[model samples]
Target: MTSFGRISIMACLLALLVACGGSGGGDRATGVEPGPTPPGGPVAPPEPDLPQASPTPYAEAEALFPFITAVDIPDDGRPLVDFQLSDAANTAITDLSSADVRFIIARLAPVPEGNLTGNWQSYINRIEQPGVGPGTESRLQATTESNGVFTNNGDGTYRYQFATSITDLPQDILAQANSEGLDLAYQPELTHRVAIQFSNGREPANPDYDWVPASGATENIFRRDIAATPNCNRCHDQLALHGGGRVEINYCVTCHNPGSTDANSGNSVDMKVMIHKIHRGADLPSVQAGGEYVIYGFRDSKHDYSDVNYPQDIRRCVNCHAGTATGADRDDLVLTAQGDNWAQYPSIAACGSCHDDLDFSRHAGGQEDNSRCASCHAEDGRAGSIQDSHRIAFEEAREAFKAEVISVENSSPGEQATVSFRVSNPLTGEDYDLANDPVWQQSNSSLNVRVAWDTRDYHNTGNNADNASSIAANALTSALPRGDGSYSVTMPLPIPDASVGPGIPASGSGVAVIEGHPAVAIDDGGSPASIPVGDAHAFFSIDEPDGLPVPRRQAVEINKCLACHGSLVLHGNNRADNIDNCVSCHNPRNTDRETRSIARTPPTDGKQEETLDFKHIVHGIHAASIREQPLQLVGFRGFTTYVYDEQTVHYPGRLDNCLACHTDDGFSLPLAAGVLATTIDTGDDHRDPRDDTVVTAMSSACSGCHDDAVARAHMSSNGGNFATTQQAVDNGDVVEQCAVCHGEGRSQDVSVVHRVRELP
Candidate 1:
């Protein structure tokens, strides 16, 4: 997710601007049924009263496009990156964390009027920073850090000291170098000649910019190539391309034109089909049924994807597009069309419902010339040419473990120290079967180590604990649960230890934090399954030996602890006297809502007797009227008065708790044994324990606001619309559509939440 420039000048300007168009209007297919509206869609009409500076509508200059240009990775192994920004060059990039930049155009001339050169096409290719990846030893210059600071060493091979102008570059590169024939007409002109070359050859060749003969020690920062806003090819042609390939439209600029790239795969088919069609439209369902398939976003805004899921009945091309796709696989590119066999038609019906043990109807030897899918993903068995089969396959398990951070073991109450490390899980012998994976379906290869300590700076120190009970007894170490497999747990120090009963600190030390979760590779939202890895923490620290004494450790990064624990009412510190271990799972099982109890079965639409448990006087009278209201009632997805931050995406809104479940304990005693009450209050002075109360005997008669004949037979439990027997208990009725289906746990009657107390 980082990028700035140079991948053969962004793959020959993304295949010569993929054939430019979208001067802002005209390509409307907004989906979800609005199909017929885009020719001028999102509401189009005001072109007549123009004149006064008539040059805005490239769809209103693409709606003022402030920012959202992501393309990040770009070292030789191209994927595309050129993102632009203009403010007449004041260049105030706002944020994608520090504006991010990089360069290397070399020579691209066209300035006809004032002072422009022509017929040049050079580019040399060698700036390297958007997200580092090529070999490693040549060190002309390098530096990295984010949030903690020190960003942009000129884009890795050096060249981003910031500041630039030349009209801000983007008008689809004069229509992508006039479809590669270099046409630069219109009120047009160009120079883009950058070359900062550094590894200390004292700023190598700068005939105003052209350095690419490296040896180390980098610097080059001169930038140019501006002029966009002609509705920048209407939303960068609906982003998410190069990968899923195809759909920045216009047959994707004929073949990604402008002195194009893809020389048998240096990559440029308009940036590898827009990054493989935006990671395969992040796994569609028409973009996850409106939730937009996701990985995240920023090329112009709105795309978070709330954790992409999509998997209700398989689809997603053998992970990287047939011919078996495996050369290790992690994705950089893998499909190979042109003559179309995609391993025999619809890729074997999208992998026959989960590899149905692969028979593809006898390998379709009946048609669709699959060529036997290269016998198993072409490593060397042949079927190559998707540019020799899309490269990247977990690079030796991604360079087998080298992660660092080797020490930080603070602890003192007079003194005590012991923190350890050693972890590995390379797997080469292949005796596999960790339950065929869903992250071990539910733990078996279970290797977890999460120790967090700082015991709030060793509480009252002096070796801590002295009968002073409760803060968890001085707190230091207690969440230990090791499984058998790859085992290890030294546990033996604590200059202080001993809390859950007297002064809480559990151990005699100040800092004993150690972490490790490892298990990577996972992909089961459903079907053509994938599970290369999972879990991974790895953080390290362990000093306290050279003559004893090192009490202060620090590592942070649970995404900065979700910015204040994802807030909402002391954020779940909701009592057993404040966070009683979050009532295990937010209360509900015993009896609260003033000892609630009710029922009356019979009515399976027998026209009477219905009334189920009414959840503790209806969630304790709407949670005591929203804790006596004054504005604190947010719940339902508003997550109680919201608050998020995520660096500044902000939220601060929402509320709603209602003891989570009319809880004095929870789930109100199996709904008082499936209710059948008329008036039952067996007294203890109404359960007096400082007045515990339960009231009943008809709370004020009239059967407490009627409904005596069982809430109209449980609201006609479906029999009212009858179609009957499709099964999970009726499967008949209709007319309920609470927003078409309930939220989250989505259930429109698959046993209506398990037939709520079925005595009917």
Candidate 2:
């Protein structure tokens, strides 16, 4: 787990807000009720007079902008791809001109479970479903001195046959790799494009399609013969729609600016530096001083970001767009734009970790001005520059608390003993304890000392293994009851000596000595600076002279709910499968809307709100489809809006699986978790248990199979779409309340409203 370092002073402010009240109005509309329809019976809205498109690629992208005003991509989704070339105007690119080009494909790095990289790119594999069109293609071909070639074959119409003896490794890439100590082993040339004659050449129809970036300067024709992944469109379509213009579709060019030169140096700005500097906003004083923090393109486009608010301290590039830390693409460091000295321009420490002392202010003969640093580091920061750069700053250490061994002596050598530690949170002031006070969850705040002793290695026979029986033999497990403030743990030490055998040191004690707060920096009085957590340590004993076995102590990290509970895109798969994302959307607003009637109160009340044991809607829909549990779509809204589409319609994102992020080993860590249920409550009564008040349970809105037209209609509509006329009458006009583009009538597409109502 990446160290969040100290809970910078800024995080304290956020914690304060959370304490003052609940997170303010984080919930979105639960339903989309359609407004009154036209005079005639419901008809498809007139085809919008979308911007006319010229043959130019730029014009095409611009034309599509009007329809995608609201940002459809969920928040946790990768940031929108910016395509505007440095020094380029807001205008879109109309040219597709290239001297020579070849199609290239590359498989994205696999996403591991629960990791951010996993969260961002895991959907690629989720696309292997039936009936959906092919997903995105991946492959790379040869490159010229300056031009690289990439290839893409249409779905199911392409082949992947690799001819033996074909020159796979491009000679030039090999040469460059050899000289630079870089690995470019995968670079190759396509022997030939498989025949395009499809056995059944059927024109498959699917709204999901994407442009595979072309490589090489030479012209070539590449056709995909296999089915592509449906999830490909999830991000691509979102990028296009968000951009609102065709000239803006080259999202790959955003962080990977095709040709961007740095402000101060003659070198080009690499992807790593750009992304790092962007995400590390506050840490960079130059950036915090009203720097133009832009990613280029997607501006003035139609994205409904009205609800997409972020924490005040925006994360630096690596925070989200991490590098090798998450096991993502290691070459993510390669700069897209090239300059005389592009290879070693800047790195993470140089760019992402903005320690302003690296600037001229600390250098000799450097005039102490914002320009002092920007002059040499960021050129755009020059006087009258539109684009501003971030400045780095350092924080003077208030105090550093390192963990020290107060005392450690075995009462009976290994039979039983008590460890005592007096740890301190140095940042604490006379008025409060940072951990106990509101600052506990602050960004920079941390437990001064997290010392733990692990005998797992001592008793186990295998490498780094633990002896289950031996562990049970000791009282150490019982002594360390997770959150207990005391540090000393007593248990039976099987071996009298702390040292292990030859390979394994009999000195089997393993402990983590946590000390002063992690080094943390923040936006200064306009200067980028860092402060060190003063003085801390951990002390223990072992049998041998070698280092003792250590048990790593992990600090408590808050779980980000939006990771799996926000936006979802389902194309080839069942769209309604996005229940996980939907829950976050439909869940009631806890911070606002005080309901007088207890029955209307939101279910989320710091309790076990989601009862995973029972699911009525799932049974109702699938059962009725297969002729099992028969129930008519109930309520006015349901009948009009909640039509079920198994293939095309899908849940916005991942389906909520209890195990996806939770690991209940019976240990209750600091994070929120499911409570142990003693009894199975299949109670059908809709009443609040807190009080004897009448309450609407999730069973009504999300579980029951009631055949109510109004309910069905309401459920059918999308959260931000127009509610059907009947739904509007029942739930009120969604237009005025949530639609990003409000209009007098429902001229826009409100099909989502219809979708929710068409339940079985």
Candidate 3:
């Protein structure tokens, strides 16, 4: 017998046993007892004695209680369903009346055979074949009056008779099916789906629980395991729809199947097409070609997703439909059944749903064949594979220009220190001669080779105030090319004055930062894309009398940022892709005065300056949406203002999910005490007001996100203002008292303030 026939036969047998008051077998396994019948009135059975258990141990219990065990659609026209409502211990739940149960019956139409022509009518015609017509409410006999009525069998089971004709379909739909030679009475190919929602006297907060029999079916043929909900929820926060009521993908697919279409837009509402078009949004070729994708829902309300831009690269299919990659949760795209078209075949309809500009006639010759797609687009395919097509050239070739700092000679400050370094392509293991190769020569002439010297004891002390200077060079002064694939540059180092000491003890241990960026062009069958191939010094310390080489404390993990940004490139893409390198330039003492236009005037009331402090700038940029004032920054080009109202800069994930981009207790309070104060230009416009303000380190980071008037006032009250904090610090004031309340273990700590509460 066929799979459906076997399922139907088994369902009938189970229904028969329940009707005759026989236990549906397997009582010992469930620890359930068959109840005795009562006298006279239909002989009601006694409730089974159940063991006391936790409120929700359903996962461990493997309980099949309160289940719609069997649904029977007889050939002779009678349609009914048998239900067993009980607790985890198999005690029958007779307290639930018929009103407590709600049922929805739907028909599962098979996938269309041919390619879906863009014409809506032609698509509908293909799905309207014999026993394959649209499963509308009228066709499925789904009406308030036609709802099944429950008849308690008095033996821990209930029978609900549909009391409707098997062929009870709308005239128009029935005529279409009949014309296509439909045998409605014996349509074994057409499957039915039954959904049930029940309440067991739970509070309104818990409300009712819903289940679909076909969704939970053990038989491989019946279960629908397409894109799981959790996968989508990774980015969407929560994949809820239909007025935020329906959340399950199983329930959504039932009505959004091949048979479904929007009556208002006359568009296919199939799950594959709808979801693809929605996520692709404004990027869809059709939408870019001056067309809008509008889904008309209940009351013909239109949902135009033309402005919805997906956060990540949409070409990264594995981001959503996970594969056999490390860290991936599930592989939903892998086909589990033969006839599941979306999983089994690469069709024009599915692909064109996103790439709407695809010329179907030109590509397929007006044919529906997609069998050859796998040959080129398969996962393992090389050149023409989907992965290869979307592979970013720069990301693949990033290691080509890797550089390392070899040594820093001449320990004393006043002497000419010799800094040695080497550059090599890690991918090819070829030593890159900066003075020889044309590309390297061009990069050297542009002074891409940079070296910075700073005291290792004081992290982020790279301002003009601290005797620190960075030098850009075209070639090494000595030009000593060693046999070990290394080169040297001798340059005069500024003498460190012992009297010019800050809060930290003046120590001789200094750090040397060597970085270089070489331009490389990668042709990946499309445009010849030019990108900066770069690397930085891991660590190189200058020997000092009393100072010890201390590296900067870890704050943010660059890998975590790359998880979303793919590659974190900033400052006109000249900077190396490392947080340590970024911190070296974007130190707390540095400001964007040189980059800012000297001719431009400041706003009358506020300053027109930009703080390049990594902590302040990074936090402010990410929290720009909540700021009351604009985040103005001066760069290589000119002044730029990030006004949240003017431009949208959405941080893809939850703001309070700090671990998404942080590591090593990065967000922990009681920050490094002696960190330099952050400068803030509280200018209303691009112009500086010359009233630059300096805030305490902690205050600057916190105010980036909490930049309201009240927060600013609070900071000001605590000697943490822009203009006064620096003066207070100079006068030996305790400006770092921010930790009094916002420190770790305090009542109002950073964790407490940024804590994410569950949705109400």
Candidate 4:
């Protein structure tokens, strides 16, 4: 008997013994009295010992699933094949019968030109189903029925005896390949794809049921390795489709290989053609030229991807293909088979997949034979190499404009301040005079050389008012050309008088910024390319006895943004790349009113007050998808309005990934005490006649994203107000006591509020 059976018997015997009063005291069946104790007061009854059940075997403790280990096909005349199966632990699974495993073998044959009807490249193993047309010729080659006898080896393996050999394939399949100029008799050249589905009646209880099905094909037989799913998942989260049953790339390639097509749409579904077109989406030359790229699948459902954007430059081949990684050799990019002419060899079909330019053939010396493509497009070749050709020229010359401020002195209200600065090529360590170079002079005309002044006490409070007051030094008027590598400039300061207001200080602290376009250029193998780059600042006191410089708070770092954007260039031609320079212009007092007035579609209220505060704008732009309205910003020079539609500004990843951009715990909470006030334009005449409201720093920053009615109401319930209360006093203007609960180290901090455990 089995151990389980023995345990059951023991249980029944114990119950019967208890019913019969077998404890050596009383006869319960006859109702007899128990024995009496005579010595030392009272006697204690002896305890009965029960039999213990045996432990279960390790193998039987949990259910086991079958896994295909190996497949063997002999060259002998006997038509037979062998398969090996094992458990998860590699233990032999010798108990499964022939009915436990199912197999399908397919020959990867080339589709003939005559058979290239409908979406032939996307055809899978679907054979006749309802509205869908008859599947492609490839499906007919591999039937769903089984025609072999299984012989169990009794040692965890099975041998299947077929009734035919390779030569015994249906005459129709051989005829089709022959029409396509393929020789099926050449066994070594033909690719065979195999699929196996296994079940041991235990899959119902397992969570990973789909994984029980396995599929694989002859590798390196006819195709090149292009993209991997893991790399795609870096942004796609997970590449799942068709109800997610098909997840592995290996399985996808078997059906998505050559000879597959969608009969309903008449489009080729080859991996290269489909993936390129899918990612290119609305950008495809055909789609752009008034053609629709659509695919029909499943129950004749049409999937049109004419509006999908690839997010990044499609020319970045390395972004998807593993073979494009640094230091990869030529063999990594080349196809393995010679017979698969369309893609198995370097051809225009592959190159033009994404480029969509028919003129490439003309550019490649009009050569019909693509064998010489590697001569100029080799991986590590010279100038015309694929890698060198795609290199961005501007990125290669970025260091030429790197500049720094040496010092700033004699900075006082209505006084000419002397500024000294130097510029150099970071790549070559060569110094260049900014005031004399012809290229520098031409571009420097648009450059801004300015100094910003603010109280030292406010700067120490972590406030962003370091640039509260600024004065520009006209390059043509104030700059003195020094023959040396450095240059000097004198500019009049525009600090406000102390008697102007209650919060305004006369001579407590000050800062000066000497920044402008260095106008450096580099030859990009063609014309000279110029980019904006130069920034320098200094801290000092106007009239205080002792002055100590207080550094500004370091929040977001430029390197973090570079991780995704490659290069964070903004404001026409790279002037706003630096964080310090960005904050200088996008401060509290700045607004988009000037540009809004001339906007193509100005606000109907006849008043526009959009704050340019850095914190508020950044949060609003990132969270634009969740906002109820569009995010519109006006340009500083062109008086142009830039509107960021929610659909177009999709963030690549989850917004809760704070560390993806922030450096320190800077996103923690309660903003700096000295942050400047912000004016909010309600755009509704019914709410307020002025339609302009001034809010505190923290309130403006949070409301930028949480502009919902409920959020606004909750904020208003607290001390948060949209309009300024007291204009002159430091913390008394907006009266938003946000630090009471949402302050750093508080119960409900900013981090706690924005903390996202999982993407919803």
TM-score of each model, in listed order = 0.21, 0.26, 0.64, 0.60
Residues 607-673 of candidate 2 have per-residue lDDT tens digits of 2222211123333332232222232221111121122222112222112222222232111221112
Model 4 residue 96 CA deviation in Å = 22
On TM-score, the stronger of 1 and 3 is: 3
CA lDDT of every candidate: 0.24, 0.24, 0.48, 0.47
Show model 1 residue runs off by greater than 4 Å: 1-19, 23-250, 253-255, 259-334, 338-449, 452-487, 490-760
Worst 10 residues of 3 by lDDT: 1-10
Question: Mind sharing the TM-score for model 3?
Answer: 0.64
3 or 4, greater by lDDT:
3
lDDT of 4 by residue, 1-760 (tens): 0000000000000001111001111211121122232112232211221112332222342434333333434453223334554444545555554444434444444432212111112111333222443334332212221234555554554555443345455576566555544344524344444443333333211111111012334343343234555544344323333333233344445445444445545555566666777667677898899976666654455666665545444555554553424324423232222212222234454566666656765875675545566566655544255656566656555556666666666654434557776667787787665456665666333444655445321211112222222456665446675667766777644444533222343355555554444433455354445465645555655555554544456678876554344455565453534666556556555556555655665644344557666777777766666776656776643245555445344454446555645765766566664665565553333122123356666667777777777887778777666666225326453466677888777888766676622211
What does candidate 3's lDDT look like per residue over 549-621, in tens digits?
A: 5566677777656554445555544554577766666655456554454424332225445666778766666
Model 4 lowest lDDT segment of ten:
1-10
Give the Å shift of residue 98 in candidate 3: 14
Q: Top model by TM-score, which number?
A: 3
**Which should have the higher TM-score, number 2 or number 3?**
3
lDDT of 1 at 619: 26
Backbone collisions counted per model: 107, 164, 8, 16
Residue 255 displacement in candidate 3 (angstroms)? 6.3
Most lDDT-accurate candidate: 3
Per residue, candidate 1 scores C-alpha lDDT tens digits across 368-428 of 4334544544445445443334333322332332212123334333233323332334554
